[model samples]
Target: MFQDPGVGVFQAWDYVVFAALFVISSGIGVFFAIKERTKNTSKEFLVGGKQMTCVPVALSLTASFMSAVTVLGTPSDVYRFGGSFIIFSIAYTMMVTLTAELFLPIFYRSGITSTYEYLELRFSKAVRMAATLIYIVQTILYTGVVVYAPALALNQVTGFNLWGSIFATGIVCTFYCTLGGLKAVVWSDVFQMVVMLMGFFTVLIQGTIKNGGPVAVWKAAQEGSRLNVFDFDPDPLRRHTFWTISIGGTFTWLGIYGVNQSTIQRCISCKSEKQAKLALYLNLLGLLVILVCAVFSGLVMYTFYAKCDPWTAGFVSAPDQIMAYFVMDILGHMPGLPGLFVACAFSGTLSTVAASINALATVTYEDFIKYWFKNLSERAGTWISKGLCIVFGVACTTMAVAASYMGGIVQAALSIHGMCGGPMLGLFSLGILFPWTNWKGAAGGLLAGITLSFWAGIGGFVYPAPASKMMPLHLNTSGCELRNSSDILTTLAPTMAPERPALADSWYSMSYLYYSAVGWLATVIAGLVITFLTGPTRGGDIKPVLIRPVCNLLCFWSEEYRKACWCGVEHDAADMDLSGDYISTDILAMRREEPTEISKKDGKDSGDDLPGHIAEDRSYTNAGFTKDTDL
Candidate 1:
């Protein structure tokens, strides 16, 4: 309902600031490309030669997924619902801790290039292919939504051509990611992160000042009932309750940080396992900072528009545009400030899209191309990886145009993750935590999860909840200048509750937040059932390094029992034969051999066919419990 204010709002200085973002981003790519010119191997391009620092990787891990979805969506959510969404910080903490303690140790120790590579080692090649396909689809759709966010912002504030902006953003991101690979992506993320923070602070400080100070902002939020923090309701259908946010949100984040290729690629790039752990741990702080700023921005938006009610008064087309509307209404006169915020939105897009395409390229090269061309050269591999980045980049750009028709960028992004990420996470969790889960179980679980999640997700969109179910807080439009009482009454009409939908539509009306948990639960449940019905994998058949030390660390089993639980055998026999049909011959030989023996023999052993990282250390000790080398 809001009118486009047009490109007139961005002054010359504003244009300069916006242009600088792309220039600097491209410059970083060129810098890294030149630095790593001689080392043009797939390993270097894909994971920075496994020599990245903690801070940049930490920032990259945070910035990769914290796109405009969080920047624009969180504030909109707070304004429409309440500030109780901040409780997701709890979920984030749990997600990070689990990732650091359980997931990272295995992936880093195994020296895996693709996150899905472990699926083949633990389950089967079929499982690996399935997981990789899921990841490619999930990241592409999510990147499209992320890229669309900034274009929407640019169109709202500057009346920029939407398709042109999407293409420009996507091409710039593809150029950098393709030119410099992961190094460029991570370093640019560091630069973009600063711009994003500054942009958020600008809105916060200026909006607070315009609405009188922090005290006045707080008063306005309190009057509008926008200060909600805790909700203890037990209803599963009620969105944003403490349970759904903390429990369901924990699963959502775990699906992203735990097994997603974008985050795992950055984590494994650290110079050492310790550095990787530290990077993941430090990312929690970065996530909380971005989250707090975005949440407060919502409070600030409510402070100024508390009386005007921009969406209800038909001054903004959607709730997500409220931030842009607020900026122009109050800060348009301050040249370069509005452009800074738009740049901030694009920064979010660049970091996320670059990360997505890089990860997509990695998985594509490792899972698909390597199999088709078994003897591909390292140099050719690197170039092909770069080409794949370009391909995915264009695909993401095209999808961004399609995403314009998708409602509410935030929900669409999260829903895609729930439908795809949840099943992937479940598959990985079964492989690591439940030793008895077999390849058949993993495949069945993933299929079941995806089917159920898609059914619920599509059904929800088809039969959206009634107005009564939204549970939005009170909003006022009585203070609008020159608006009569009838206009005010009409503006407030949406507040009137309607009858609840039929019970048959209950599943369709379930909270969007619960989709991830539902899919995860479905996968786990179905995986366990299928494993039991077929044949559960024995611990002796699985390599001990593949399993987390859950029984040893968390359970109170006696030493003897724990040893039996270690690899489904007693401590002395923990290195039981790994000559299973599922495992490759080199892997079986490596498991049978000792790392010290290989070291004494100058790395000449049965693992000669294995990759360098795995063959050098045989990955684990004779005990099969301790890693013999660091990644």
Candidate 2:
């Protein structure tokens, strides 16, 4: 083992940068909660009153997926493997297009509070509850991973105990998410995004200057085969292939951004369905730009440490610590640089955790508690929501404390996401894409999809696979001879990975990147098969949910079908029924008659009976939790 000199310690001002973030975030939370207390309803607390513009939602979306996992894992992955992973941008592109085209209209038009509420309208309450349960499980696990990623990294370089960092992150995020709800979360996320971008420039500019420039970094990465971005091989065992990443990433994001409560809430919160679509589309560009810079930073790290492999030389405990190591190496001399970078990492952590806490609370209140305790007062519901945020915050912190027991946070996070995301995405797709898919079909497909997903995920991730082991790209450690190797090695014994199993050469070695796509296909295929086998529902039964084209595809067969479809939406008067008003089920489980029709038929101007804005103007008030919507 070899070692490099450490970057001594943080100055007093460094602490100031971190402290300011806490104060501002806490104050924002308190300010919003109290300010909105008068006008605040369950709707306001959850979705920011649905008056949001595109930029904030877009930025929040960017912040969600820009977790510490990306900040640390991208650099480590590039260092260990190649930059081919950057092809995931293609996935982001697909997510934007597909979401804008198929998902946004249905979800936005429905005007429901929770994403799972769409399940009840399309299928059954059972499906809604089931999907909600899956989402809860996925997000809770995801929050733990998100919280743990930065805490672990900060611990390695700054000597801040992981436990302390985890607890601190949870407390601050919970406090604000509990107070201001969505507004506070969104504004805090905006602040964090600025800090993240600042950290990006600091590392890139400073690291590039120290490494002799961009050209030098490129040359170093090229020599080590770290710049390979196009691997066309179809082998599932060979991870990071182009098809697997792009296709797999597409489904993974669709599972997350397309159907998850966190991202959907942002879309729902937009001023209009069109605005949500625009914001979601714009989110793609932001993610691409950030990731491109993040990937390059990895190559730059290789440039500076080309002659000193940190993992092999033993300056760090794991490969994930490389980013913090490089930050200290290049920017350590600048008094606040280290703190800024740590802040950047925590920005990802705190924004994501806060977003998750808020979304979890929102869903719990809207989906589960709201239905059972129908008569509960608004104040009591809000308090319960705040309490839920605190509970989830603590749960995430606890998971962080135990996160060390899990393996690589990067792959672990992706796999956990895929394992749950796939099935959930499938359930939503069934409701959106195929109208004939009944509750039975959705339930069966979801169960089977989840089972297959877990089996493949566990076999691929948890179990051993020897032949599939990724050999580290050759390292140039000649420049690392100045320090005594034994001393550093003694403090942290370099992890010698365990031996692989014979199954590594079999189907069990399938890469986790493609798990998202796998889960989605299993669900759709299984859903379609089951729907046909068990007597299918009438085509009329589905017009309320199916995409227009799919519904239109059935028009040639029957006149009744054409008349029955086009379930909602305000179309031209030419298509209006003889009765003189639109009949819509958009307010699922809430209203049976359109307000205009109800008022006219009842012979009274009684529209106030329902919360009218609940239809389109309500959505998630907080930031993009993991996928980055600000509060």
- Please tell me which predicted candidate would have the highest TM-score against the true structure: 1
lDDT of 1 by residue, 134-201 (tens): 89888888899999998888888888898899999998999999999999999999999999999999
Model 1, 329: alpha-carbon shift in Å?
Answer: 1.8
Candidate 2 lDDT over residue span 1-631, tens digit each: 2336555456677778877878888998998878887965767788888767788888888888788888888878887777886998899899888887777766765557688877876777788888888888899998898898888877866778878988999999999998898888887888887888888888889889998988888998898899878878887766678987888888888888888888888777876665787788778888887788788888888888888877767677678888888887777777877888888888888889998988898888888887788677777877888888888888877877656766777888888899899988887887776767777899999998999888888877656445344545787668775346666566457566666566645656777877777788889889988988997666555434234335645673665555555443334434333432222343221232234542333564343333322232232112111123221
Candidate 2 TM-score over all chains jointly: 0.88
Candidate 1 lDDT score relative to the true structure: 0.81
Error of 1 at 175 (Å): 0.3
lDDT of each: 0.81, 0.76
Model 1: residue 137 alpha-carbon error in angstroms:
0.7
